[model samples]
Target: MGLDFSVVPEYAHFLWIGVVWTTVLTVSAALLAFFGGILFAMIVLYAPRLLAWPTRFFVWLFMGTPLLLQLYLIYFGLSQVGIDVPALVAGIVGLGLHFAVYNADVIRAGIVAVDPGQNEGARSLGLSRAQSFRYVIIPQAVRSVTPPLGNNLIALLKDSALVSVLGVAELVHASQLAISETYRPFEFYITAAALYYLLNLLLEAGLRAVERKVEATR
Candidate 1:
């Protein structure tokens, strides 16, 4: 069949809905992962061995598995056990939890990249360890950690497509529905790809701006 985009207008609303959900899911998951990662990294770095071991295992569990499977466990598996969750909630939580491990590693590395002498200097100034970590260490780590965090944000954006499996109506799902109705897979799929590319361009631009601002402070 000849390439045809005539059906696009009829399903533009579908794609738009997909765009909205993709943005919402990415932002929510990114926030959860970023902050959750900070907490997890702290536990890994400072907690007693007993606590740290289990936290590490939790991170490993999430990181090692397929995220789509994680979504199934959270959305379908939990419901089977009498804990019902909406698809949107499941999508956000699954993506957040899965990525938080990588963020933990990124953050942990960033924290350690701050010189040991800096920590000792903060302590010699009579700052408590916690105060030093909060005031001196974290600020320095933030500058080093930002680029990797931005890269992960892009991965998170692309992976948001997986949420369609949970029936969350993200970009892929919308494209699938349009393809089913119109039998024009190329047109819809290419449109979806183009939309994702545009979103990535915007995200990359934002990341660049952030990196420039962070660099200005150094």
Candidate 2:
């Protein structure tokens, strides 16, 4: 059958709302994942064996599981256990935890890539281990990891579509709703894909600008 895009203009506003929620979910989850990743990286790198083992296990658990299952557990399973969670909240947490595991590895690799001599120099300056890591190691590590983190941000943005299953009203969810009403899946889904592409393009541009700035400052 020939494609019909006539339904697009009428539902543009609905799609726009979806875009907003998608952006919100991506940003919220990305921030949470980034910080959580840093924490996990620190735990694995510096925490005692007692702490590190459990932290490693936590990372393994999330990394080992499918994000869909994680989302289901958080949103649906929790309710089953008498702890109800709002769809958006559950989505954010699920995305955050899933990405955090990967981010932790990126962060840890960044930290490991730094020269050991840098840490020694910081210590020679009478900086404690924590102080040295905070002031010297983390700054350099962050620089090294920025590109990977930017890529993860893009991935997170794409993954936010998965939250549709939880009915968070994000882009794909909105598209599905429109399809149900109009029975024009092609138009709605194509529009949704275009919106996602545009968003990723904008995000890539922004990340490139930031990367250039980081490079210029170095």
What lDDT tens digits, residue by residue, belong to model 2 across residues 1-218? Answer: 78989879999888999999999999999999999998999999989999999999999999889999999999999999899999999999999989998999999999999999999999999999999999999889989889999999999999999999999999999999889999999999999999999999999999999999889878
Q: How many residue pairs clash in each candidate?
A: 0, 0
TM-score of each candidate?
0.94, 0.95
lDDT of 1: 0.94
Give the alpha carbon lDDT tens digit for every residue of 1-218 in model 1.
78999899999999999999999999999999998888899899989999999999999998889998999999999999999999999999999988888999999999888899999999999999999988999888878999999999999999999999989999999999999999999999999999999999999999999999999999
Write down the RMSD of candidate 1 (Cα, Å): 1.5
**Candidate achieving the largest TM-score:** 2
| Per-residue lDDT value at 217 in model 1 | 94
Candidate 2 wrongly placed segments (more than 4 Å)? none
Q: Which stretches of candidate 1 lie over 4 Å from their true place?
A: 121-128
